[model samples]
Target chain A: MKQSLTQIHEMWERFPSVQKELQDVLFIIQDSLKANDKEVEKALLDMFRAGGKMLRPAFVIIIGQFYPGNASKLKHIAASIEMLHTATLVHDDIIDDSPERRHAPSIQSKFGKDIAAYAGDYLFAATFKTLAFHTDDMTVVRQSTKLLENILTGELTQRTNHYDRHMTLADYKEQIAGKTAALFVLSAQLGATNGDAPEEFVNLVTDFAYNVGMAFQILDDILDYQSTTKDLGKPTLQDVREGVYSAPLIIAMQNKPEIQKLLAKKESITNEEAIQLRDMVIASGAVDEATDLASEYTEKALDYLSQLPEGESKDTLVAISEALLERAN
Target chain B: MKQSLTQIHEMWERFPSVQKELQDVLFIIQDSLKANDKEVEKALLDMFRAGGKMLRPAFVIIIGQFYPGNASKLKHIAASIEMLHTATLVHDDIIDDSPERRHAPSIQSKFGKDIAAYAGDYLFAATFKTLAFHTDDMTVVRQSTKLLENILTGELTQRTNHYDRHMTLADYKEQIAGKTAALFVLSAQLGATNGDAPEEFVNLVTDFAYNVGMAFQILDDILDYQSTTKDLGKPTLQDVREGVYSAPLIIAMQNKPEIQKLLAKKESITNEEAIQLRDMVIASGAVDEATDLASEYTEKALDYLSQLPEGESKDTLVAISEALLERAN
Candidate 1:
């Protein structure tokens, strides 16, 4: 566990200055989740402590460094983004019926779905409240809200498309754009705006973040197929079991037509069947194909980063994009 | 059906000028819900067509009349409040597992819980996006977000306290303050601010709206016990069936110890037992007690309106408060 922590820490070493600031943002999140109801406070505190990569906040901090703005205010925006991300995870856990997150019993698992639902909602409200109150700029609030709209829409599309074996690559890409890329864009753009960067710089970061977000989610889908429960902190092929076919599964079906028939079946797939499907997907070279796609996105993100003025922030951004391509869990 | 429509239409007659604007807001909402996915759009459209009294938006229009600012902007804010209310109902139906709403099958019932969850979340994102983009005032956005916090927290408290027969009247009040009163306060306060009303008037309308909201919820609870399913548009004794003891049930339990014992049973109440409990609640005169309490709130709301400057809006506010007390369903 300590080695894993060290690996995670190494990923953020390029932006080491934001480490203490990120801790401050987490404390702000904890304080903001405090409700008149003690149970709500406890639930939120537990979820926060379960821990995450805090990647979204780090992105915000790293991008903000490119320009001149109040680091404290940027921290608040970063906290809001993380809380919003946390809120989505709470709901996603309920929707997925997963019993664990961050290697601990999930909020819904421990508190019941009903409480977990409200906890997710409370976090969302907290996110907006923090954005509206803490940020001096209304543009930041407005832009963040638009990003939230995209994220929820992506979620809606994904839910509607569940069990749809006919879902195409374009459809999957659109879903991930909403579910994943929207927030990345918001983080980078809002950070740039916070730093009082030029519009050209803001747009460049937005493009970079979009590609990074795409790569990040593609890698996540890949990890779901290849990583262990101990490493990914959840069971592998869980998405497929739930009838959600991510990038690799989608690409694999094109090569292995038999895989599509198995997925189309309405009944639950047995453990042996799931393993069979996993082997077929691996054998189809879909893993390699998806990896190449992720790398392509990461390359594009780096290309955008290179267009920005030379600075430590640009270097950190480039490092983060490259590191995302090589991540295993 | 015509009578019910007439009752609803009459309620909106006082604000004839804003009728077109209200329709425009609905169109904006419809446009916002349009996505690449047709299923999501259709579900949202159906839910919107299930229809509501549009009371929150009406309150915003009425309150805005008291000041002089952009009517169009106030309309946008009003739409956002209604969308927020709609979003809560979508989630609440899922939490309660309600099959029907507004005399039609609920979003969850028709589209499944997963889709309904996203639909609710989509509406919420739409609400915030509307508020952030349409209005120029950060204060309005900030205050509205705070109200949303209160609303979701109230919902959390309610969910946590489900089936607890020991739930105090104060606890119930606090829950309603968050769930019901907070939105009303937001409607009035935002409307007043949009119209450029003085801070004094804004605060006055907030107090007025808060009292109106409390009364509104008390009456809603009372109707849940007294009205037929056909009239209420859903089942009655639902609270008791679900172990959610509302106003009359709480008031009756104080007078009859047997009611407490019956409620303490963890098993689901049979149809016969629900009818019997209804009889006991009526026999205990708890209905009258709850009614008197609701009336007291309405009176306070009217008193606040009387303190405001004499205008058409004040008269309309008083009429609405009085009408709310007299509402049978």
Candidate 2:
């Protein structure tokens, strides 16, 4: 849990106001998950302490500042978003059988998959409890609940897409849009709608979040090929072994159709073959091509940010967006 | 899904009205789960079609008849209760890693654990979606969502309590109260509150549900000791293998202290040991003891039902309660 917090924490240090908001979010999550069973309670909190970028909550909190929203309510909503993200992560690790989450052994790996499933289920239920407790608006509850559906549908789609050497770049975009961006859009939308933000502004922030999420996910997919286990705080070639074709691999396969033979290994993918495939994708210059797409999405996100009225919140949003794009880990 | 339906259906034949209500619930569940991804949609439906007793929804529907609530709205809430119950069952199978459910291959066994997890998660989201879509009452949403918490908290507690040779009657009672009774209580409570039922009546129905659920779960555990795999539609003596000591075993252990040596095998318990444990439990007359306790609960449930003003619904509740208690499968 402590592994990447040092780096992610350092990034948050530059924006004390946003940092304070995120700190409150952490507390609300901790308080909300105070379970009757101490072990059940501790399982989720331990995962929370193994922090990530907190980017989703940051989006909710940062966008929350522009005619933003209710003070205490925004934090509750932000905590809800964070908790949903973590629950998906726990389930995702189980699905992928991935050993690490943010540089720590994943819940599924550290505990049994049964414990992992329960912990995730606990978080899923806690999320709704938090939202329903804090917000009377059925729209908030309904939309957030559907947000979970969208996320899982994306996952199911990707599972079908798995090991298909013909998987296209378009498929990747659609998959990630649902898989990753839906939550981001919801986070921004909830913060804006929570208070007095007008419809026009709510629409604008959702567009901004949509773009930011697209770029964020593309960057994440790229890092799988470019970053090390230490840098990513998870296995580097993990996706390849699991037969999940991300952007760089998809682009590389297109440019060099010969790579399909290696991908055709599917379940039989050997460790050495996985390493070879990684080297081949990097060698094919797909990393640079994928980065160009990420940059374009980043530019679009910045364009959305540029339209917001001038303020410290807007400036902080811009700084964070740029830092997120330029991040090494 | 079809394995035990013939038997369960024969029991339901006497109550055509409740059967009709359940049919509508099946349609609502089918309608709610129609998805963007056909496979994702089909996955849950297949599990749903794997017929269940639909007892939870029946509780909601029967209680709704007392106040005679909004027709369509009652169906939706009943659907939500059924979906929640099914979602938990899918997760339970995954946790137990059991080979069968209702005389059919479990979702985890049939679709692989990843798909099973997604299928279960999808149902959880759909359950909330059903509730939110049906009512604007945040109390309904809040309480039902917390009901999920109570159910999951019971599950988490069980994991900690697993394999404990020292498990007591008190521990078993407390565990089943949360695990089994909470949902039943919520089912009855939601239906009563859905209409104009007074606070006093709601208490009566919830108390009835609590006693019924306790008896129902105790009977289920008892069946694990006395019934054949074909009779139960699930593997017999499975809980003993999993170290889930229930009423029969707990009662039998008190009668036969020598059983402790066998239970002390714990994780290393062999197939023969599991069968031997079951035989010993049955031979010790603990099954009879467990049946006596279930009948006592059945009487308490009937007493609560008796307090309700005489009506066709009350009579139906009494009939179903007795039938459920006398059920052999």
Candidate 3:
């Protein structure tokens, strides 16, 4: 769908303030980080300039549009969520040994592991500091923090269970909720809190974000298996190389004895095995099944938007939910 | 300093409640972490049982004890600080490549790199969640978070500068202050804030803690070169092995030509090279100079205590400052 003028204006209005707040919080750490060595800062800044969709921050602002309070404070919260998302991506690259991110060299690839690790830490610290700017309500502080905690737990769970073919869809869902959906949920909740919405509205939006976030991740997982390398902007069968078994792969493993056998080995799968696994997943209709599941979650998210009092912000949220589904296909 | 029955009783009185608050926060994350994986929970609990000096929390409580107000609220603050400290240590082991921590296998060693990484993340989340329990004052949340952000920057600095011989004593001090002393200063400030002390007192105590914390770290670096392996509870030259050039080493390197040459290729320095560097550090009296600097900081810390109102808690702070110097000799 084409962007609405109102949506465009809202997006435009939000970006500069959020960016400024982000810069404000990050300045000290940005300056202090350089004190250790100049190379660290240069490499990190280069990596950070690589483009991101900033989907999480957009959601946060869309939610804030409903409440109409201190726009600057809400913008700080939005920037913080984005910073957190970015930090996780940097660290995830390290964990997955990913070289390319956002069509550019990952911090890990450019600066090596030690510098990448420091970059990730700096971003994480910057996120917390940005969030601290929204110090008016203890509840906001509490929830934002709890969101970070959940994200960490998800990361740990994924780490501990790496490469296990036995992981169920339930396990995948829980893990992704922590790792992927968590910031999404937090973004929506922060928006509601910024709006001074009722606690129930915040809860509903959080639930909506959670489901959509799960569907979003599942779609990504499916695309990882089904999409062309060019389309995905990365290698085919990347998750398997990183020892992460996603939902579609889990489903495909049920019937494909050969793929399962190949996956059980510690070494990288042969290119032939990777192709076979990919083809098997598409042929078995597991990708379709996961896509259908994602749609269900999207529908649930739309229902959440419908429940909110009618407004442009609410309508935009509904539109965004639909757009997110297109990400899967 | 002799043991005081009054101080011990006060600690006992405060410990259970503070622990309970920490447990509540950990329990939230544990529910999700331990839902499917029992190992994560079991390992974390084992670490908790290993028990730390809980110095950060104690500092929080001691400074807090001097002021008048609800003592109960201080529990969450102290617990949160301790949790942050725990999370930092968990990550530090990965960076330091230490095998053991607190007399047990480091989380990185016990659970492998992936889980260890997650465990650190979980603790980080838990720390923030604990902050959320403080529904009364958002300032507490904001200030505490600022402290955390500063500390993480410190860690990033240390990581980025690892094995660089060019780093000056000034650089070392800045890194240590951020990584180690920032939280110590925060602990005192948080304690003072909890007690509802005057801003001047809080500033004084924070300065005291900052100096004491720096002294503590400088002494630690000195002992790493001067003390036996068993006394330090790890290898004698562990920091140099990990590529961290401490203050004493920095000073020693400036004086010794051989040491300068040895340090130039120091990133891949072997065990023998590390010991040789350690000996050079000792022989140059740089260790003694570092110790003297630590003593000066310790004296300043005690001087701050003397300016504070007379109380048993104030006396304890003085004693702790003095004890920090003893760690060097």
Candidate 4:
């Protein structure tokens, strides 16, 4: 987390254009919100103020420079990516059935499910609206829209397979690809699409983004078991509580006979039982194995970055990749 | 309901272009559904075949003619409107918790809530994808996208105001604008845009479509209370069961103290209570009042049609307007 934060800070410090674009994107969304009724406006302001890490937007901006580095368009692209991430988080709060997020009452908890849903819808619509202003190229719109399609497909897969205990590691990977990595790829792809980068550079940067996304998500999964309730901001053990089986738990369940037995019982895995399973996951070397797998993805990301045309943006992207892999530790 | 069906049939019969576009739209949606997973494909097929009257597309075709319809562009416009309508229905099923629709298991019930949600998201994405292919005009896309924004806003408004006994007529109108009339208005506006109709013409046609939509929806509300279970292909008084108080109920609750008491009681309103309230609504002259309002809107639609350059399409549009008002009876 520390390394990831440092890398993000460096990227933010170096990219003045990224800062301006982000500001412009916020302006676009805020302008749209001004049309809402007073109550709706109040609710939207709360959502706006409950700021996130904006890591996804940062990734999008850094990668964007590899393609179209015009400071003007980068903000639109960056803001759009951030909006997508925010939309997912808003929806996730509902699906998780949690009452709070980011030290504030979750949108669903504060405004009710319907308002939260609309707020997400609003942001999603607003993101595209911003993009429409920035470019007339149908190709970009088509690709970005496809990215959203994949994300929803991933969400559906998660919902249908919840708590089944029969979900495979392959299926889990597919879900992550759809939900997490797809956006990263698109962010990188969009970056290149907007600029003079070669087609191969676009693909290479996309690979880097995808690998970093996978590593980031796997680390998130690891933290669900590894971190305490206070350290994570939200509740710990949320995935197990909500019936989501992330990579670490999925791997542990697959390899450990006792873990499989406990999962099959279908009773609430007590805190102690969850702790025992967590220990087994750690002891069986699956966490280490997962961490190693993440490192492989990180190295692949670095490999892609190494081949790209040399620039400060490229270096920042490589640093971001390193930060993601180190977060797993 | 019977009258609405007749109107739908009549509209299709009168317009060959509408027939062609309907076929093309259905085919396009079908082509979008070829998943590698057989089960998903089967579910999507079931959803597609769950026959609708295709009223939204019909509205598009009728309005397009007023603006000098191009048979080629009409296909894309009609298909996009229908796709948007279908997506809304899918999302509405999730919101309403409905188990059945149009005499078949609702999409959410059949595919589970998650898949249904994704299917809606997919359909929505496909709509933009299809639209993006046809044109890069920000005007058309902006109008269509704003339609979705309004629809979501209406859904949120309804959810927050649910079971509120004192909701104003303005509130009810706004909700209907978002929930029901938005797509109809979009259909007309998009048709005009595609047809290259003058801006004034677009305004008139969209206003006509909107009024017709309001009247149509009010009639739908009346049927929920007045129609029998078998006639509706649904259980009687189901709207009341779902806590969706409509205009008829609102009028009755205000005028008849006994009806108000029955609805306000802590217990669930019995079928008997629903019947009594329904009868009181009719007796209070509210049903007739709403019917007259529908007629006024119908006249306004006809007035717009009369001012248009006369053609067979104009006559059909007039017939459609008459049919819409006739539906309230």
lDDT of 1 by residue, B241-265 (tens): 7667788988998888899898777
Q: In model 4, which regions exceed 4 Å deviation?
A: A1-24, A37-45, A66-70, A162-166, A267-272, B1-17, B35-41, B66-72, B233-235, B240-243, B257-262, B266-272
Query: lDDT tens digits, residues A162-205, model 3?
Result: 88888888888888888888888888888777867888878888
Per-residue lDDT tens digits for candidate 4, residues A216-291, read 7888788776777677777767677678888887787777767777777454777777777777888877787777
Using lDDT as the measure, the top candidate is: 2
Evaluated at residue B222, the lDDT of candidate 4 is: 71
Residues A1-329, candidate 2, lDDT per residue (tens digit)? Answer: 22312233557898988887788788888778776478766667767777678989888888888885578888988999999999999999998898888777888888788888988998999999999998667898999989999998889888866888899999999999999989999999998887788888888888989988988998988888877788987776888778788999999999999899777767877767777888999999998899988888888888888988789989999898888887422
Better of 1 and 2 by DockQ: 2
Predicted model with the maximum DockQ: 2
Distance from true location, Cα of B162 in model 4, Å: 3.1
The TM-score of the first chain in every model comes to 0.93, 0.95, 0.85, 0.88
Q: Which residue pairs in candidate 2 collide?
A: A1-A50, A64-A68, B1-B50
- Against the true structure, whose TM-score is highest? 2
Ranking by DockQ: 2, 1, 4, 3
- DockQ of candidate 3? 0.41
| Candidate 3 Cα misplacement greater than 4 A, ranges | A1-48, A196-207, A303-315, A327-329, B1-37, B327-329
Per-residue alpha-carbon lDDT of candidate 4 for residues B293-314, written as tens digits (9 for 90 to 100): 6566666766776776678767
TM-scores of all predicted structures: 0.93, 0.96, 0.85, 0.89
Query: Which residue pairs in model 1 clash with each other?
Result: none
Per-residue lDDT of B12 in model 2:
65
